[model samples]
Target: MPDYSLLARQLKALLDTRDWLTNSAQTSAFLMQEIPDLNWAGFYLQRSSEQLTLGPFQGKPACNPIPFSKGVCGAAARTRQTQRIDDVHAVADHIACDSASESELVVPILDTNGALWGVLDLDSPRKARFSEADQAGIEALVEIFCQASDLD
Candidate 1:
């Protein structure tokens, strides 16, 4: 079991630095290495007009751009909440960028004023990869992203 509290704290510290982009990139790399049984760990950012463009990510090449209502990342951004799918195959609108991925966790990153900004997306090659505890942990990390100073 990953120590989510420590992970969240580490993420918060990383997000607090002046270089957010560099930090976010590093964070993605760190998560990709730290988290277990994960095929992907990265971010998708929404910059203008509700468009979610691919950001720093670590894994197999993912879909270039995802709509706000399309995949798990899109749904999380559209709903401004977390989306955890045990089986990607069972998800009606699941986007299979990596056919090996069996599970996914999407955490929406909010701005300071509680507005949708982007999402932290993680995909696992193993089934039932994310649990409620994982959700809670990642949500804490996203909350840190919301309150952190580095988002632009």
Candidate 2:
């Protein structure tokens, strides 16, 4: 029973006057604190032509650069869609940067032109930590982040 409206407002306000890169860091911090049962919360950005570079994140250090066609982050970037994994063990090509993470959710952040820019990734130690409601709420937050922050 998370207050999505309040969360969205906070994210929007934080990003309204901040650069995307800077604001993304703030957003990750916010989510890491707000969300319960999460072991990791962060952003993975498309730095080069076909690479997903690690961005500001909360939790342990993660894999530096994830390829565009590998792992959950890559699948989200390649498909430009949200990836909700209830069980990380079941996901093929799963990256075990953190052995304690049992579940993961990845939401792709798109620019106004619908270009793949980055992704917001969340990991939980509990299996099936994310629900449909969580997905919708996070997706809404992503939209707000896109609208408020400068993609350039």
Candidate 3:
């Protein structure tokens, strides 16, 4: 397990600007660089109530406009909860943006007003790449991101 505490501090320091767009891009790059086994790291912003448009990301081209009713990202947006799937192939509604991805983690990004701002998504090529500890750690990192950015 990576030391999340150290990562948190590093992220806090890395976020020198409060701009959401820049921060989101930096955050995505930071996650991809710091985390192991990750093929994709990015954000899906909630432009409409029922859909998420692609945001800053690192990796291959990704699917755009994920609805709130489909896929793991959709599930997280609809439920306002983190969705950690051990195997994407097992999901009946999994969206195969990257055929090489075997596991995924999506954390709902809620603004301070409790409104859905977006979601932070991470994908790995290894099956069961994300553990519960990883979920908690990433969630904590997302929290830091929320606090540091101007998501309103």
Pairwise TM-score winner, candidates 2 and 3: 3
* Off by more than 4 A, model 1: 13-16
lDDT of 1 by residue, 107-134 (tens): 8887666777788999999999899998
Please, what is the whole-model Cα lDDT of each candidate in the order they appear?
0.83, 0.89, 0.97
Q: Which pairs of residues collide in model 3?
A: none
Question: What's the CA error at residue 100 for candidate 2, in Å?
Answer: 0.5
TM-score of each: 0.90, 0.95, 0.99
Worst 10 residues of 1 by lDDT: 143-152
Ten contiguous residues minimizing lDDT sum, candidate 3:
14-23
Which runs in model 3 stand beyond 4 Å of their true positions?
Answer: none
Q: Give a tens-digit lDDT track for model 3, residues 1-152.
A: 78999999999999989899999999999999999999999999999879999999999999999999999999999999999999999999999999999999999999989999999999999999999999999999999999999999
> Local error of candidate 1 at 125, Å?
0.4
Identify the candidate with maximal lDDT. 3
Best candidate, TM-score:
3
Query: Per-residue alpha-carbon lDDT of model 2 for 1-152, expressed as tens digits?
Result: 68899898887777756478778888889999998999899999987977899999999999979987888988999998899999999988999899999999999988777788889999999999999999999999888878778785
lDDT of 2 at 47: 77
